[model samples]
Target: MTVVRAKLGAHLHSMTAPFLFVGSGLSRRYIGTEDWEGLLRKFAALTPRPYEFYRTSAEGDLPAVASKIAEAFYDIWWDSDDFSSSRKKWAGSMEGRESALKVEIAKYLSVPPALTGLANRESLEIEILKKAVIDGVITTNYDSLLA
Candidate 1:
């Protein structure tokens, strides 16, 4: 770990310019104003174990939970419309929301293990190297307040 950090530190230090490719991990937090988090929190409140599920990765398939979350989003959008819409519209909206929501949920479950491995790398960059993100950080996380 230390060796890898040293090598990366050396590489970064040698570079004429400084930049960091900070990704969604730095932005996404379980706490936020997003309807997704609210749904998850509500699910936790109703379930036998909320925090446990939040901390642990979903067992087996996650599609069921993902669907539930998707349904919640669709319901909200539908409620906002003053006039009744066809099922196709709701389905389309649900499909789009479902795709993005599922990706995020899967990312949430998978990111921790991946990040754990990179923890040393980040630590070395932040603490030992004291590198700066010279070009500024860019991310596409909707939950993030970068905009």
Candidate 2:
């Protein structure tokens, strides 16, 4: 890990404000968000089938399982009154569609992680990162944690 970090640090130092490629692991460490499979499994609980079934059926292909979950979840979302608020909110845009999965993901990630009351090195790191002289930011993260 140290070697990887050192190499990446050297690479970043070479470029003038190079775009940083942040991934899920960074969010997992900083904010306690689940990894991809764990996130898929969490949504799978709302589907007709268990998470394991989707995993096995998809041959452990997580994206495939995610598609399956999306399809099943759409049915539930459209037919249930519990999601009426979702429907009303997203009406005329993505209503009566499988896009509820996107909304669910957004809602799941919208909550910012609590970083207060931290008199620690990591908090100092965050402060430094906030003042970092990067050209811009790029991330695969779905949340607005850095925004």
Candidate 3:
């Protein structure tokens, strides 16, 4: 979680906020088998269009290629009203969805390295954050996981 903390610190410094707010989202730790299936389902919901779009595009500039992938991801992310709205609520109007996704992606990136040698790999620091945010953690990304 140090990376998460460091990034957050850098962000707060850059923003120089009179008011700063945070909301919790899902970690892999929160996901159960069913929840995992559900998130995969959501991801699957958007994959085909993006995949096809990318497939059809003959010329691929690196930036354009990346943008195409993002557009596809956004298709899945934005389609579900509850999912999209929860993100907005958790993020408030101040933070962008990309910022939220970055934090989540970072957590996913960091967890594997940190837990590499552990016995019970799934249960770790995320539990503490989960407890702290029982009421406040409002993102739909992990709702099924927590439930």
Off by over 4 Å in 2: 1-15, 95-97, 117-119
lDDT of 2 by residue, 43-96 (tens): 899888899998898899878888888888898877889788877888568844
For model 2, state the Cα shift of residue 15 in Å.
Answer: 5.7
Each candidate's TM vs. the true structure? 0.33, 0.78, 0.30
Q: Model 3: what TM-score?
A: 0.30
Choose 2 or 3, whichever is better by TM-score: 2
Error of 2 at 147 (Å): 1.4
Error of 2 at 50 (Å): 1.8
- Clashing pairs for predicted structure model 1, backbone only: none
Estimate, for each residue in 12-126, the C-alpha lDDT of model 1 and write its tens digit.
8888764556444554332223344443665444334453454344452344554554555444434544214433333454456455444334434433332233455664643
- Model 3, residue 33: distance off in Å is 21
Question: Residue 32, candidate 3: how far off, in angstroms?
Answer: 22
Q: Per-residue error at 61 for model 1, in Å?
A: 5.0
Query: After superposition on all CA atoms, how large is the RMSD of candidate 3?
Result: 14.0
- Candidate order by decreasing TM-score: 2, 1, 3
C-alpha positional error of residue 6 in candidate 3 after TM-score superposition, expressed in Å: 42
- lDDT minimum window of 10 residues, candidate 3: 16-25
Residue 53, model 3: Cα distance from true site in angstroms: 4.0
The candidate 2 region of ten consecutive residues with least summed lDDT is 90-99
